[model samples]
Target: MGRQCITEVGLWLPSLRPGVEEWQQMLSSLGQLYVQGVKVDWLALDREYSREKVALPTYPFQRQRYWVESSEGSDKTTTKHPSATASSPITELLDRGDYQQLTAMLSEKESLTAVEVVQQLIHLHQKAVAQTALRDCLYHIEWQIKPLDVASEKPSQDGQWLIIGGEVTVTQKLAEQLEQKQQSCRFVKELPQDYSELLQLVQQETELPLVGIVYLNCEEVTSHEEVLSQTETTCQSLLELLQALLQDESSNPTKVWVVTAGAVALGEHPISVAQTPLWGMGKVVSLEHPELWGGLIDLEPSKDVESQMEYLITELLNPDADDQIVYRREERYVPRLVPSSPSTSKTFKAEPTGSYLITGGLGSLGLKVANWLVQQGARHLILLSRRGLTEETEAAVAALQEAGNKVSVMSADVAEITDMERVWKQIQAEEKPLKGIIHAAGVGRLDTLEELTPEVWEAVLRPKVKGGWNLHQLSSSENLDFFVCFSSIASVWGSAGQAHYAAGNQFLDGLMHYRSSLGLPGLAINWGPWAGGGMVTAEAEEWLAQTGLETLSPELAISALEYLMSADQVQVTVSQNDWSHFKAMYALKRPRPLLDLITVAAERVEAKTEQAPNLQQRLEVVAETQRSELLRQILQEEVALVLDLPITSRPNPEVGFFDMGMDSLMAVELQKRMSKLLGVNLSSTLTFDLPNIEKLEKYIIDQHLVGFFKPETDEDQQEESFLETNLLAEIEQSSDQELEGSIDQILESIID
Candidate 1:
């Protein structure tokens, strides 16, 4: 293969090979020659000269393997490799060679054999490869190409300020303004009065705390014995400022920015005093004007002012920041769509478009859902998974690209708090709201309840339940439309050995119901045995047979998802018609009859009587004594537990239990049960407050609790105590058995 090393900025890779070990030497040489030292990331190799590491892992068959016969003596010992360490620079470097070879082959008119290429590449000559090596390398590299662009810098949330020209007035004013706004800023301003004293002060105060810079006219500065006296003085002052900032714990150790008005001026004074031998020119810029620097420096701007000042500052201040971190194989490749923008090929319908988010998006269901959504004219599709993609996943991404859909893939673990937070921040930052969530990533272990440990339950439930609920909470954004929680049918119909998985999925289902009742539209897709991709295969079938349920085809499951996505609103109850049907195993708990509940209540009261004093006799005796102080303490704790809201010393109406904004779902359930027990209507409004249990108890006594259970309330007693109509009679009169069921049944029906 033909290759050449090009050192010019933005032009590193060429189509020819050089006959020298240039990796380390290039850095030293660049440090000496280039005004700005070479910028590179250990993780992402930018500038074709640096090596590339595959961002996504490859399949075993797609990677080359070399099995050499054991060498003799010390040579054999040397050949036996030590276990790979995570931080080993050698491992990182060796990995880059694969990318280098592929790029070299790609640059040439005729492809070179893997062995032939490795032999020519002196560092990798001893690395062995079998006959299928070259093909495998190409397969892996196919999805590793990310195009290079300067605009790929991380966007700042702290906001930015830019200084232009030789005037320090605007710069100083801007800094003060930003300071008032509680923003951090730094500036490079020319010192005219007491230059030496000013330098000392800048050195002392302008450390890491510097957030912006103010460039003053060089002609107004003190003179020095340099070639360009005024420019040199300005540069020297900046250097002093830079040193002071680097020294101070608060000041940043970044370059002291110098501003020029045009590209012509920038070219003449290319180097700044703040420039370091390790870091090139510290970054450079030429702007048209100063005032427009801050406002017009947006990446997706419509104006033509390049905002070179902002670009320079970003490059210099960003620690270990480089576009090269994006894994790339060849310099020629370009992404068809911009990473920041979602460009959908199909138009969305007038009706709200259902968007689905898949955690573990780089996995099977995640990828499938992404593709399926694109086909359904989804306005946007988000892949929230770990920061990895297998070789297969990358290829799948490429296929989505060919199909003309935009796909956003990010690294995150559904279970980890930090990962979930990052995902949340990414969504907020990108302004992408998720409508549905498909939690397909979960850990499962076959164990009975006795065998299941807390650690195991937490590990499984974190991703399946807690992770789902966290997403649900975060999805309170108005843009959120519906939440779809993927659960296992095993939750509804318990599996003996898979008690852990069943428990985990059951938690998900319960949360789903809770959210739905609160009026947050959602569903729990209780999946049956899954086939095709995922944790199932022919071999898996044998193990799964221990738990008797017919496995579901992956295609059919996906189709069902598609159907739901298209329907106005879908509530499906899917199960195989065999003995293993999910319905057969779901033994719904029987609801207690009204008469039965009355007996249970009487029994509970009788049990409590052993600890209680005779109220009638106690009240007559207590008329003679003040209330006990102990009663106050007990009442306080009881209030805290029952209300589950912060209590104030004074009765703050806003801090009531219902005023805490408990969702409609929780309010309804609590109201239903209390109404049935006390035979009094309970307010379902989140803001309704009951002063205390004593007040409720007194009201109940006055109303004769049983009388309040009537279908209609007496107008005279309405304000005294509220109660819902007789719920038992309403259900008893229903003609349909399904409709006659209580609140639990209604919830199940909605979910189904």
Candidate 2:
């Protein structure tokens, strides 16, 4: 068959050859010829290929393999379960109701995670097994649970230390004492004044592992220029040094202590005015990176250093120490919170004869203050602004003049020394002795730290720092009855985006102290946002409101100012805030110790949380038909509260809120109140977006209350949807007259 096929097909298979090597060589040569582009036809073998199917027997077979014997014990009954062997010691202690033992074990266990400890405590509390004992145990266990996985308890073995600006005799004495205690120390005596050079030095010095201590010694300034220059240089140096230290990974110091000789504790002290910035910056730096901050020590320059050395050394060694600010006394040092008390009287008198000079006096706040002065029996008033009198301010001035007071308008820049000098000369020429000065001239710029440039910072600081300095210098010997520098709460609690503004206000606070020390009458009022006027822009007012800051009314603010005029305190912060809301919003990033001062607010928040269901939960149970009416009442109440209007006089639904005297500050307050009441996250511009009560009500019902009232079943949901669609279709199909009637009915129901 193969030979016949080969002859017919002109092909032959390799099996036809007797020698295997010869046939393989022949096939290889043929394949090589094909690779060389030679096309070959089919090759047939000696035998023909065919396929056939075969049947198999169907049978099941059982087979088993022998298992290996256990390595330790051949008997399975002698072995224990894996779960029994893996039981945790913490679990055992907890199950035994031995909370004391559990806490001790947790404290000593190096391998146990904080999560495990927390879980055990939670389980014990949930089970209601020895509740009081578990609570006490949990409190003790909390101290062992570190927030960050840091080696906080580990002491630094490196003895080298870096001390900046400890050239003062007192600090030098302390340094000598530390050395005598066998501690190695190095002092950078000639501190760099420029920020760049200081940064470079910090980088170089921090490259090696060493603790850093910054000392801000009190220094006297000969002139206003010197005060500004020194303060600016010191602040810049500190800021740069902090930045460098934060970025240096090779030498992450356990703690950085900032020591200053100033009255940082809430009080009036005159000699350490320039040193106040250190305190403010120290506070903010600590908040920014609590892990790296050691503490802020404010020493009395005259106090002996020998007694405090032990406490200081303890603070340096203990990274987890709490008290951030300390002040020295005769025998011991203590922490202090700046205290503010109400004024003794509801009203106070201003100088009757001398003119009251108000910088930025043409602005809204300035004009209001002018009116206040006129009412306070001042006959002469000087209003200073860069653009002396715009059409609006001109009208205000005319009205003030009509009210039987002499109003003088000056076009001059308060920040410019020449402009300020020129104005001072004018005040002197008027023959009305400058009995009082209100340094209200300032600008507020909201920018993040990264966005702050030299120009932006200078713009904000110039009016406050330079203007305050100029006013202070020009009126130092004027025998003024009162020198009030209008500051802001930003200085007290650092605002998120107002670093420059806060720094500027802090300088004012410091300057007030300086004046107080010299027996000069001075007071710095750290006022919150003023309702209807001042440096707060519309955007700023909205942001402040959303953050739970309420604006002070003009009447209340003026009354407070009048009372403060006779108060003995040099610096006081005045504001009406919703502490619960403020804390919730502000503490989202991190906790603030300053907020602890608002004990009343904290108590109120706790009470609210315990006493009430949150707005969302309350709204969820309300019927859909009743929600619109409920929202209307809430909206009206909030509006009345914000606008300071009578609740009975609900404004016409068709009228715009802005037309009804709702300004930016009021709008923000209304938005916040509505959001809180409705349990909805409303926009800051809700009032603007909706424009009136009618539109706002419809928007709330449509957007927030859509699924607020959940249906009990799928059938109910479908029925509700069908009804809503049919109602809409019927309304669309109805005549214009019928639609008007339906709208009137709805409005009447909501309004009623």
Candidate 3:
């Protein structure tokens, strides 16, 4: 074996830096060692020469070349230009409209580098396209394809998930569960507690790729003060945040889910009152922006946090789930329903021995309540108003005093804490302990969201939001028999042009719940528009009537309140609504969850829709003269209805609607009824516009029934013929009163 000198022959071992000759020599040495029967001890050999571990790259880059030709129809020679690198494979895919593959490449882990490169290219391309389109549209007077003109891409599912307002434990658990499922989540540890901060946060985070936002209810509050603070803070923050998010054009979150306590699902929980405003506002928010809402999830108090969180995550991740309001009970999550509960009586009596406070007491509804209280055996009543005494209010107060109830008129702004404190001091010093309170103070203005200025919003919120809070804080320890808040159906149904009003009333509803939780007597009544004495304007009333809501008679409303006072209920909606009519009006954009409570109306709406075309067609075919006649008849009938007179007593065609005892409310009702019946859009001032039946009939015929029919003779010719006719001779021969009587008789005969 050419006895290998141990010193000259290196040990047969792998080397970090090895040449081919060294490897050959090592092989020769290994052969010699094996032939000489030298048994190699593997464990004894030095292992220190092992390769050092190198840290793996965070992300691997695949150096694949991507390029595209500048011109699509170019020859092979034109494709060789170096400047052609402007377009990449990603841009090519976008140009070809293969978005699915692009989205897949962006989502797959193996193609992360490709995704970054593609995203940059796509962004550049989009910018170029947008600039070109805008420039062309603005300067060239040409129709161009703009960004919004392009088909919208489906929302990316890989964006960061946001968890807002959940308990620390529950949010943490939810985050862990999401991570386990390999989903990316960003937990919002703290949310803005004030409206300004909330608005700033929303503006700052408007560009974040937030796929979803899940809002959990705040922790339970123990004190009434805390309840009011937390509830108002949360609600205001939510309102501002939503307004910001909806207004954001850069990157609005794809979905928003509000998770609250199950008390709202059950329809009453005093401790849950602070959260109820969010529920009401959430419903309106969903209706206002259906595309951004995921759903409302209410977690049962008795359910385990871990399980509820698990179920919540599942629902949040699901894209096809239909239910918008869900309730978690024990082991399963189910859809929630706002079921109507039968009125139940509770043993309670209103003792009129002590003084009672009523805010907005000089308003129409307030006076009615004051009189009702007097009739109910209340002796002392303290009425508060910003405007202490008008002629109308003075007369009302005099009547109440004569009816044997001692009335004190106080002029103060209930929304002002100082004013409220002064009033409370005066009440305590001069009168008996306050036995009851009715918070009926509120202001309503109608304007679209775009027209809502901060001043207008604050004006509407002052009396309702601020006043309710002031009263609740001051009266928390009053031990009163009843703390009643006069809320409105706007909060329940979310009336158009009344967002602020609705939000303000919703806060009152929430405060009622909070009061109940403290074992204090509280009741919130959401009354419909009042027929006789209420703050509702004639225009607003007309709109409400068109939507199938009848004005509640003062007598009926007072009776309902009296009955509600004896019931063991925290909140009640007292309204005589025609669900069928309301549904028909909103058939195209009906609000869910709330509308789900009126399923019976859906069929009626469908039937109305099926019959609507036939009615329209019939009207379209009627001759102009006949159509005018039909409109005149409808006008007469509506006028009769408004006046509470027999249809046979229809007024003269030449007499003005106002002259026939048609006040603003009656005129509004007449306009509403005529508008609905004739399928014509009429303004609240329709009676004022034409004034008399003949002029209104002519205007309707010309504006709505034109081109379908024509008069047999010209207007001048008809007037000339009328002057020469026997009717003119009779009118000229008769006395003025007799002629007027004759005209009335003729009108009556025509209607009959």
Using TM-score as the measure, which candidate wins? 2
User: Which of 1 and 3 is ahead in TM-score?
Assistant: 3
RMSD of each: 36.6, 31.7, 40.9
The parts of candidate 1 lying over 4 Å away from their true place are: 1-356, 543-548, 565-573, 580-752
Candidate 2 at 631: error in angstroms?
A: 36
Predictions ranked by lDDT, top down?
Answer: 2, 3, 1
- How many residue-pair clashes does candidate 1 contain? 35
lDDT of the candidates, in the order given: 0.41, 0.64, 0.64
TM-score computed on alpha carbons, candidate 3: 0.54
lDDT of 1 at 623: 21
TM-score of 2: 0.55
- In candidate 2, clashing pairs total 1
Residues 440-551 of candidate 2 have per-residue lDDT tens digits of: 8888667655456667767887788888888888898797989999988777766766767877888888888778878898888888787775677666666676666766
The better candidate by TM-score, 2 or 3, is 2
lDDT of 3 by residue, 342-393 (tens): 3546734557668989999999888888877875678999999999999878
Q: Which residue pairs does candidate 3 place in steric collision?
A: 270-517
